[model samples]
Every structure is written in C-alpha cells, then in structure tokens.
Target: MTRDNGFSRRNVLRSAAALAGVGGLGGVATASDGESLRQIGPADLSDVPTDLEAVPAAAVPETSSGIGPGSMLFITPPGGGEAACTANFVWTDDSGTTYLGAAGHCFLGSSAAGGTELDEGPDLADVEVRVCVDCQFGGLSALVGGLRGEVVELGDVVYARQRTDDGTEVGFDFGLVEVPSSAEGLIDPSMPTWDGPSETGEINAGDTVVQYGNGVVTGETVLTKSRAGSGTGNDDASGSWTAALLAAPGDSGSAVQVGELGAGGLTGVEAAGILTHVGTSGTAGTNLQKAKEMATEAGLSIEVVLAG
Candidate 1:
C-alpha cells in the first residue's frame, strides 16, 4: 500500500485537477447528535480538494449527484470557484437513487469531540452531474457503487487528479433528486436486513483493515484501510488504537470488517480524521450506537450491527 503524507498540496492539486476534483472529518453523533439549532448550507461549506477551491462558501443540500463511483466528487455553479466536499457519498439504496450521505458532524459544521464539522445534513440536494473532462471507464468499486470513484474536483474545470489504476480522473453531473432526507430508515432499522451479526474491529497504519460495501446480496469487495488516529470523535469510544491507514477522503463513513464470510460482517465505521501535519490517512471509528444514530438521521435502517 502507498503511504500518504497528506502535505502534498502539489500532489493534492495534481489529483484534484486530474479529478477536475474530488472530496473529510468528524464530531460523531452518538445519542447526543444535533440540536436543530445549526443552520444548514453555505458560510460553512469549504471546497473539496485544495485545487477545485471555491470562493464564497455555499449551502449543502441533502442529495447526491446522479453520477456515482468516482473519487468522491461535487460541482459548483458554472465556475463557482471550486467545489467543496458536499458530503461523503455513503452508498445508494434500492431503485438506484444515489443517496448523498456524510457524517452527522461533517453535515453539521459545529464543535464536537475530535471531528471537524462542516456542511449541514439538511443541505443535501440532487443537483447537476458533471463527467470527467475526457475520462471514461469505471473500476470494480465504482461500478458497484453506482457512483464513479475516479478523481474529481470541488470547483469546475478539470485540473488534475490523484493516482488511480485507470490513469484518468472521472467527473460526474448531478441528476438532481428532490428528497428531504434519506436518513429515516435508520431511525427505525426495519427497512430490510442483510445476513450478518458481523462485527467491528480496529487496525493500525500498518495493519490492513478490510470490509464489504455495495450491498448485502451482491458480493463482498475487500479494500485495505490506512488507519488514522482517533476518528472524528475525540474519545477512545470513537475509534480503536491503530496506526494510520491510507484511508482517503472518499472513505469516511465506510464500514470496517474482518476478512471472513461476507466481508466478515463489520468492525467499525471509517471516518476522515482531523489532520495535524500528515494528510488524511484515515480514522478508526466504532461505537455502533453512533453509527445507528447517523443511519437514522440519513433515513437508513441498520439492518445489522457487526458486533465485535
């Protein structure tokens, strides 16, 4: 695996340009999530990568771009400076409706344990979608995600991109959905069920963390995590003690699991940690209660919690 230093503005910019752009952070939501006092939208929204940097910030909507499977991506108005990390593209639901998901903390730019709160959860919207300048093809993960994970930008104009096997940065346009919040199902949790008591564990920077995404019935895709320090939350309950994984920006909110049958259930949720000098690396988040809360806010149900 490649060791990410996180200080490469040049490299980040290069990746951003290659992406035209792409998508971090945390105060995790436990029983004590939001208070409804926080206002959603701009003034807090910052651009995604350093490259597709936006000028004045804007409000985030509760929607995902029509395109999927790219290195986390977003677009600005024509040339609204650059794009900001709208939110993490948590995965999609049935019927192919791409859900624009993010941590309650990222959606809520406020103060918290150890996470960095930015955009608001209610600000999601299915805006327009933009494709990579001259890119095509998707990867195994992207293809499964319904989202294209190629490198992307926050602002307009294809600048550069991070490294990828495809050798091309992919961009996407928003299909524009008119949903209020897809986080409802989680609060209830009975939407549907995947087979797995599963479980949650931790990994260090050197250790390889693995899990399954996409969906339950489909298949398990194994990817390694770089293991950042404490996740978005400050307390030990937030994450386990792991070195730092090369967990990238697009990886926040991913479910960590053991390499067993069916991604071996789950270990913990991945979060984009607070960066000191090093770059993003990754976060080791546990606390299933917090995950359940997040799922509730997003309107998704926790089919199962992989208890360790």
Candidate 2:
C-alpha cells in the first residue's frame, strides 16, 4: 500500500470532484453551517491482528437516559481546529469506564492512507469531545460542556483486497474517545427514533436500515442489493452494508442501525454498524460486530452499552 503524508486541501477537493462525478455518493457529510470539518483519510494496513475472538455481547439495561447514537459530537483535535462527527454509541469497559466511538481519522494529524505514520501514535492531550442538545444540521445548539477525555484507542486499518467501484480498498476506521467521569450521567445509549438497547445483528444486502448524523435530517435509507460487491471497497461485503442515506462531511462516525421497514415505521431496529465512507451510491459502514472484536484486540474491554 502506498502511504501519503498529510492530505492536502487539493486531495479533499479532488475527492469531492470525483464523488460528484459518480453522483456524489461517497463524500463525507459537509457541515451545512459553513463549518469546514474535513473527514479524515483512510489508512494503510499494519501489524494489528484481525483474528481476535468476538467479545460477548453485554447485557443492556431495560432502558437508558443518556445521549443516543445519532447525537452530534464536536471533536476538537490537539492542533486546535474543531470538527464534527456523529457519535456511535455509549460504550463501557469492564471496569465501568465510559466512552464514545468516532472515526479514527478524526484525530489524525496526517494521512496514513498508505503508510505507517500512525505507528507513532497520535497525541490526545488537548483533544476535546462535546455533545450538543437540540442541534440540527447547519444550525447551532447548546453545548453540553466537554465530555473530557483522550482517544484511548483507535481501530486498526485492516487491508482487504476488495476495492470499491473506484478501486479504493476497504478499511476499518474507528476510534474510542474516553468519556470523563463527570459526563457519564449525560449519555444515553439508545437511538432517538429506534427501539431501546441496540442489539447486535448481521445486515444483509437487501436489509432496510436507519442512520442518524448531524449532516442530514431524517437519515433513513435502503440498501441496494446490487451494490454489495460491485466495487465499493467495503470490507467483507457479506457483513458490511451501505445505503442511499445522505451523509455530509461532519456526519462521519454516525451510527447505522439495522431495522425492519413497515407502514407504521421501522421495527426491530438495532445497532449494526458505524458510518465510515460516503459515496455517490450510498454510505459505507464497518460492521458493529467486527468493531467489537477490534476494540478487544486493542486491549480495551468495551461493549456498546444500550438503553434499557
């Protein structure tokens, strides 16, 4: 794999142009409020092992009252610029430490798309994570103070021969932001519009899904069975899932939920994946099950805690 140092504005523009030509499906959700939060670039494969055993699903309470998956999170990198992304879920380690998962690229100072720069480990001292209440796309809302903590771990970038229609290889990009003890009572593990306590389930090519991100209003879409392996570079086509959900730049790391569509509404919805890439055809996500295993290998005993 070829590694590129920092991604230039030119590269992001090129990516945007490329995406526009392909019908603008893979672009990161852009903040409608004139914010310039750039999506972090993909990474190259490293020695990180991918064969770790699946961490058993944890028991979720009957309900939760903290922030849900679709909530918007403001990530301020160590360098001082602020970017936004969707929070995946409220997670907890065996010792009861809380965390929120976002895209790993959100914290990188340079591109690791084809190199080992990440081996040196990114710094997290001045990094800050925050949540906004009543915030909408392109609009402002009240801040919930900083959910102070550092990025305790990052998901390894797994190399897969699989390439997307554009020939970009699939990658697993996720990061764990440790939550300060003071903010634990403020997060809710349930999704806003779905059932409580997201359960782990495999998503198929034709499954209906719902996603929540700060970039789009009403983030729901259907998976086109035909795009499963047609060249989206999604890792494990059988396990990964995508949809026509409208994602913008700041929407990275949004939670993708698996659900049943009906006249009444979505039913049996559960957390299935986290949005990582946006394409003209749809948005790609890493399977939640795989994310769990990756976290385990990183030496963090974590689980997606759900609402009761």
- TM-score on alpha carbons, each prediction: 0.33, 0.62
Write model 2 residue lDDT over 178-267, tens digit each, in one string: 766665656667765565444766555666666555542222111210011212222353335455555655456767666665687674
lDDT of 1 at 82: 26
By TM-score, who's the top model here?
2
Assess the local accuracy of residue 31 in candidate 1 as a C-alpha lDDT between 0 and 100: 15
The clash count for each model shown is 92, 28
In candidate 1, how many Å is residue 183 off? 18
Show model 2 residue runs off by greater than 4 Å. 1-66, 112-120, 136-169, 216-239, 262-264
Candidate 1, 92-171: lDDT as tens digits: 33443334332222222232211111132223322322222111211212222222222322211111111112311011
